[model samples]
Target chain A: MTQATRVHVAVPNAPYDVHVGEGVLQGIAAATAGADRVAVVSDREVCALHGDLRRHGVDAPMLEFDGGESIKTLGVLEEVLDFCAASSLSRSSILVAYGGGTVGDLTGMAASLFKRGLRVIQVPTTLLAQVDASVGGKTAINLAAGKNLAGTFHQPHAVFCDTGLLGTLSEAEYQSGLGEVIKTALIEGEPALAQLESISRDLGARAVTALSDTVARCVTTKARVVVSDPEERGARRSLNLGHTFAHAIEHAAGYGRVPHGIAVAVGLQLAASASERVYASSTDLGERIGRLLSAFGLPADLEELRSRYSLGAALTANALIEGLGHDKKGRVGAPEFVLMRGPGDIELGVMIAEEELRDLLA
Target chain B: MTQATRVHVAVPNAPYDVHVGEGVLQGIAAATAGADRVAVVSDREVCALHGDLRRHGVDAPMLEFDGGESIKTLGVLEEVLDFCAASSLSRSSILVAYGGGTVGDLTGMAASLFKRGLRVIQVPTTLLAQVDASVGGKTAINLAAGKNLAGTFHQPHAVFCDTGLLGTLSEAEYQSGLGEVIKTALIEGEPALAQLESISRDLGARAVTALSDTVARCVTTKARVVVSDPEERGARRSLNLGHTFAHAIEHAAGYGRVPHGIAVAVGLQLAASASERVYASSTDLGERIGRLLSAFGLPADLEELRSRYSLGAALTANALIEGLGHDKKGRVGAPEFVLMRGPGDIELGVMIAEEELRDLLA
Candidate 1:
């Protein structure tokens, strides 16, 4: 039994706590202690595997759905809301989202839209969700125009990252989460970057202590960023370091074709390479990140990613550029990229021309 | 030309100005100054009559729909988002919500969800929207379960309450706006209540100065309430004075059948009567409010309301009580009602038993 690490997120008007450890799912009881009613919204597989909340002393009705990027749609969102209505969930009720990022996103969105807003407790079962998606208030579902095109910034009431649940993840799924871990390390500066590099082997082996410590660190870093800029007006854009390109890739490749974090992994490399071209920073930075990603069984670049996944004819520079046009972060002119001058030294909203981007991709 | 009164709403993270006066729609250009592009979402009839943004120097594309309670649905919300995509609205672009409360609510919800959020400038054409709905950040669309069951608290960048547009409203529509005015006065306390009493005749005659001053005062009252509690967690619930019963009435009466503010007018009387029974407050208060409603050509009680509108079989006491069960503001036990002790002396979240409520309605 590993000691649980707690990270406090101080988003304005909606502060919450995140617990990370082997058996933190038990904390769901404490998180929802006073809730009039607790309803669980979860991935179908996760519910089947670990569905009994009564074992943890939470006697709540559960609503399960197939979890994937495909489920992140407005139609699915309405179904979740309908379930909430049927469950008689009031503003005083709490909704526990139990699954990976897709379940968390869909449930978080449902909680936000159901009766204006309902308090939500996130119990993330995947490493990617544990480290990143479940911490921030950014809850979204996809529209036909783009991914996460329609959503809200409704922060969770509490987050429980039970790393014990990760024991069931497939090898590819575990590596997918490490992609975000690497992205966070790059954004967190030299010491964190070095720490991730040192633990890359242990993380690859899925060591309990290594996973717990890394999840706590990623959550701490994310909490700090979210507190400063909860709405992503300025500094919060730093968290989108690899996300702009990642979203474009996901859009061009067709949603659900490639894992989100894997796309983010390739996005990090693209951002780093573009940083070298735009800022003329150390070329060594990209190489170092690539090596770390490779050590964790993740794709280090687009060419490697293409070999691993079928991106089809959509994975073109032109298609990606066109996809970039629909990015939520986009403004009046050219889409701004979160480029790195170096680790911890990130520039937000950096405009890179289409011609220059095309040349770089070529 | 009457001077436009400006009220600053200081909702944290999103603050904007509300301008109230005749012909204030001309100020639309200044509110959306540096926007990459400006797009209009408006009521179809309003657009045909006054949608020419070119005269105001805001040459933006327009999207119009039939505006009413029927349009406040997830389906219509999706159409609005699709139009935003079709119009190429980015985060930097401005969406001008130009119509009555329906248009404002739909457009504001779309603005909040489109690409996470887009800046919206509200150009409220209806008197009800001018005083209340347009100024508050609460944007919602109805669900099959209840009215405003799905929504967000996305504040507008600016509000332009063009009193000139009220000239085209039907007699019932004009009085509908007065219903909310009466509710605001009651919650605002003595001075506001007396002021409405003094100017009720001028307001009924649609005098320009009377309308401008009254709108500014209502905005000031609402702005103060919203700034203190942006998310309706505590003090803000008082703003829902007649709204609990009002929403129930609208729900039972079938949406689009009853004017929202008119339902609120009768709701105000019911709450006043409830307060008298529960708190032993003055019986004079209910009578005083009734007179004010009559002066404004509004329904003062349920009997008056039923006489004026076809409530069918839905306006029964049991049906309304059932409707209260689905209110977003409800909790675990009994649904809380926003009761009043006297003018400007409002009580929030007062739980009245089902039997007691039935007796009061009887």
Candidate 2:
């Protein structure tokens, strides 16, 4: 694979760079030039794959642990921070999130805590992370009571998406990634949705290209929203399209049990259905969304599917509806949901009465 | 007892406010805008004093532990984060860091990690914290290898410096705080330094006016630096006038044995000595700096300080001589030390060779 491509993410007050492509690990030294040290945070899996990258003169010590969203607890973040501290990673050190979303989230947080916010670079190895988690500048860990209850919206100086890392993912994991790709495409515009629908068959070479294009497109969309509303103060709420339901699914499943993209895919279906029921969207459009998910082997029947998964009754439909009340958009005294009327058409759905929510779930 | 007597700090980004007064605990709810869920990270001592603050508002589950710099570990940060997650603190919820620097450091960090950075308000109840730690937006926990090796520069939305809390502090802790006040005064200007020096004698009723003025001046000095260079990029380096040697002293004495401010006092004395030795200034100025520290009962001897402080032999001498080598002024391929030629007069000290460092230290 070619050397990882480097790209700088310009955050108004804090400017950082993102290194892409492959063999980017070798460039870590140069990437972290101004940094006095580097603290490489990763889990067992990614460390096994690219652990050697620490020697590239990054000036940071490589710290690894068993990785999983389930383990994305405050405990793990603290451990990673201790490792960074033990390594003498100063404020000038580059904290590299060297795994998937879980690693990225925790590492980013560790950087934020070291000296009250140090230079951090995201090295996202998962397609889900590259497309969604790594782009938004949000870093967090899960708690027993909920998913992502603790986190910060500190953006990274750079994000490195080495597509070559896809070589290691299981098919299930790769497919899990497609869920976000599809979500992004639908959120983009009519062109993206039509393009996705047209390539239902043979998502092999065409699939990779489509997915990559969709990720870039989604990145641009999320970036615009983030730039405009870095703290989710206003327009950024639009990016939560299906996250409301997804958070519930992830929380109900107790994190890690449901891959983020899979949960997001389920969330999309719920949003589609909720749109039909609450916003009076075309019912046919909701059914079409199910078909598209089914075509991609994604779970469309979220209720029935919950039984097959590790779903917590407390966190599922009931908790999700309640949690939406806590979202920033809920400030208007209602959970304004993001809905899809049709392919590439999304609008904010008004909050349904609690009584109506129970009926819709039923 | 008047509400206006409270010490308040406002950070612009979150439009953050920190209130430090006799009954600031009652203000926590008001500061947080009545968020239903609250995550409070504090050590045993702080929790005891304001544990009831949790009951003042909603059902706020308090997370308490030992209060000290060493406890500002990743383990503590994680535990607090776990509490936030377990409690289902939403984006709308607020986190209160209820303690001194360590508590503020970890609490701010945990807040930053929760939901990718939550709205956090710091309630600093120590003189050291009130005038310095509570204002500049620096937060972190110490690692086994050194002090604040892993952390972030996440600013608190608000800071509370409850001067009433000072009534609970021991004389040693109170004097330690003076070290910071002195540092701030020296950097602020001649008027501030003189005022601070006068209050250093009797921090009682007669000196209350001087103390308040000193605190305000110090806070403004830090606030101004943060505003111009919040991330310690350029002008902020001025704030680290005594930190190079202070860090070494803290490291050498171990973390908790010697308070941060006390070590900073020693560091200040050393910095003055370095200034006289390196810049050819008269040793009389260094003696004056030493006498000023002694007036507040702060240690001026470099080797006699107590704290779990350790240093990479090179760092002990190099970091001070090099001004930590991370400041923006150090870009000339040489360490630029921020040194004072005389009281109220500061200049960038050029990088000296390692061989020359031993002579200066001697």
Candidate 3:
């Protein structure tokens, strides 16, 4: 992809570009001209897919780890540290995360820690990562306690979102990305929702041209919000409109069993329903959300997920509610929920009381 | 002790106050007025010395971990993450790192990771931490590969350097701080060296009032350097002048065999000697440096360290040379060394040859 189809991710002092296109990875070497050494941290599969990244002005040894949610941990992070120190990766060196969000999160953290924040470039391969994880400075590794329990806000020096990688993704993974794209569309207000509506079928059909435009739109929306509130004080929390419930669903259903984007789709439906019921929000966004989910070929019906995960069961409900309280964006006791008001508006930091939350599933 | 001694550390985006006084820790509650909750991470020793920080506006639970340089590891950092999660520490929550440099490093890292950075306040108890680690936003945890191999730069919301804490230190522990004090004095140039000369007798005798002014001057000097180059691009690397040889000496002597300050005292002596040799422009700053070390009650003789650590041996020389290459501020081949030009001036980033380093002890 060309730099022309790029969005400037304004992270205040550390602004960077998120380039979306085909053959974009080739530009990484030029982008990291000042880096004395470039170290690529990717998974074995991705490394196989995109041959040795050492040719890209990288003298240091590459660190390839096992992929998936299970691999994101402090143990793996330690291994990353050992590789860096052994390779003698200095502050002048740059770490290029050449995989999906899981690899990006792990590598980003290693860069931040190794010699107190080295320059990092996010080369997101998965659709879920390219649109969502690329722009935001959120880098994390899951702990036994919870997902994203150990992480920091380390913005990448630049992000290379090459849509060419989508050609190799499985149908399930591709659909997973559509879930987040739908979520982003809802957050972007009416026009984005309309654009998403027009492109959903093309996206479902895997049209290459449609993929590029969709990725750019989602990235632009995310960049605008993150720039306005990088630290998630108020406005940025709106981006987590469905994430409060999504995290709980992921935890209960078990991570990776159901992809994060799919869970976010379900959570957005939950948010629309809750917003309509609790606030009597003038617009009935739930119907529109359901249609969007269907159009994107996602699991629009909660009945299937509820039955599968047993949402009515005490254990599952408790896990969901407990997860909400531990949601990093919300306060400890008073958990914040983002409720929709149709189109471009969503009320962030709306605290849902225990009773309302208890009956949320019902 | 009063607010007059406070130094404002201008760290670009994250400016903070370093309050130094007798009972300054008492004002912490007022300082963190906007904090919804304050959770302290300190060892039993600091807790006993400072008492429960809850009295200082920390209503949240305290996370007390094992103390020492050994405690600076990812495993302990994970435990810290658990504590923050269990405590349900939101983005709004404040983390008070109470103790020495080790505690500050670990806690500061945890603060940066937990919810992508909480408002961290550095309450450094040791003299070394107060004068040095307090200003720079350098937070780290050690890995098996090396010391400070894993870390990130997370600036504290504020730093409370209460000289009152220095009163509780053991003779060795108190003297450990003097190493950094002397190093700072040298970095500050002739005026600070003169100040150290003036106060050395009172400080050597363990007079408390003299400790306050010395700590303030060192903090101010560090603040000026860190504010200009927080990431150690150029002038900031000068801070590691003595540290390069100091690391080698420490590794050769074995950690804790020669305390950090003692090694620094020796390292400063080495820098002065090396500068005199290589530069040849004429200045016996080494003699003045030796006297300054004696006045500060630090080990002035490299011969003592060399004899004790068996420096003439291949193992020690190799370790010292190996350690110099790994110096954080310098590249692999071109290791940076800070050398003295005159009283208030110093030449930084001087590359010493291998043969010179090999025969350094001889």
Best by DockQ: 3
| Candidate 3 clashes between residue pairs 3 or more apart in a chain or in different chains | A1-A22, A113-B151, B179-B261
Off by over 4 Å in 2: A1-10, A14-67, A82-95, A204-208, A307-336, A343-350, B1-12, B15-66, B85-88, B204-207, B303-337, B348-362
Q: Sort by TM-score, best first: what order?
A: 1, 3, 2
CAPRI-wise, candidate 1 is medium
Error of 1 at A232 (Å): 1.5
RMSD of 1: 1.9
User: Which docking band does candidate 2 fall into?
Assistant: acceptable
Candidate 3's residue-wise lDDT over A273-322, tens digit each? 88877876556577887888887767785565665446545336677777
Q: Which of the two, 1 or 2, has more TM-score?
A: 1
Order the candidates by lDDT, highest first. 1, 3, 2
The list of candidate 3 runs beyond 4 A from truth reads A1-4, A49-60, A282-284, A308-315, B1-4, B48-60, B308-315
Among the candidates, what TM-score does chain A have in each?
0.97, 0.87, 0.93
lDDT of 1 by residue, B29-111 (tens): 88788899889887888867875666788888888888898898788888889888878888889998988999999999999
Ranking by DockQ: 3, 1, 2
Root-mean-square deviation of every model: 1.9, 4.8, 2.6
lDDT of 2 by residue, B71-160 (tens): 777666667776776666766778877787888878876776666666677777778888888787777666665576555667776776
TM-score computed on alpha carbons, candidate 3? 0.94
TM-score of chain B of each: 0.97, 0.85, 0.93
